[model samples]
Target: MTATVTAPADRLLYKPEDAAEVLSIGRSFVYELMAAGELEYVELSRRCRRIRRTALEQYVAKLSPQSH
Candidate 1:
């Protein structure tokens, strides 16, 4: 039997650690990108931040050498 994979729901969001894993980088790098204004994120509260899938993809695309 074959199993099919399903994508995450639209409302699903990822934290810095998750984004780091997806990008194969260190967690500190993710924060550095955010501090450098390279990655877009939303502040859920005074201390909470969330990164969207779209933002992560855009950041990767922007960093691609071909984009330069």
Candidate 2:
């Protein structure tokens, strides 16, 4: 039998490539952001990584200016 997995209510997580596309940057740049702790990611395995939509939103918010 095969098992099915459901994505989170918010939505499925973004892969590095998807994240890069969303940010309008390169995949390497996404890795750099992760390394610099500017972006958060989840490690599913030694070879698998994903970025939550909320984390991406938070990162962008951090880069945005505060309103008066």
Candidate 3:
């Protein structure tokens, strides 16, 4: 027997650090992407921001194709 678990569709927000982990990149790179307007995020306040999972997926999809 096995169980299949999945995340909720409404669960989309993630911290920049979490995004970095997901992308296997440095946290500073995530900030740089934000600064370059390449990654989309929502500012909750003057010091709080959250990146949407959908945005991350879209960003990956928009990247240039990798060479073999």
Candidate 4:
């Protein structure tokens, strides 16, 4: 027998790649942000990490407008 898993309708956490897509940036940039403490994430295990939805929202909210 095999079981399949499905994601929730509303996601509370996102993988780095998913976060990058949400932010419209590169995955490597997401990691860089995490490394620089610019982005927040929850470490699930030794090699697993996830970013909270609110964290992503907060990151965008904290961004200053660019001068033209």
Report the number of the highest-TM-score candidate: 4
- Write one digit per residue (lDDT tens) for candidate 3, span 1-68: 22222324676888899888878889999999999999999999999999988788778777775579
* Candidate 4 overall lDDT versus native: 0.85
Deviation (Å) of 36 in candidate 1: 0.9
Off by over 4 Å in 3: 1-10
lDDT by residue (tens digit), candidate 1, 19-43: 7887788999999999999998999
Estimate every model's Cα lDDT from 0 to 1: 0.76, 0.80, 0.82, 0.85
Q: Model 2, 5-38: lDDT tens per residue?
A: 2335566698999888877789999999999999
Off by over 4 Å in 1: 1-11, 66-68
Which scores higher on lDDT, 1 or 4?
4
Output the worst ten-in-a-row residue range by lDDT, candidate 4: 1-10
Write candidate 4's Cα lDDT for 1-68 as tens digits. Answer: 22222334499999999988888889999999999999999999989999988888788878877789
Worst 10 residues of 1 by lDDT: 1-10
In candidate 1, which residue pairs clash? none
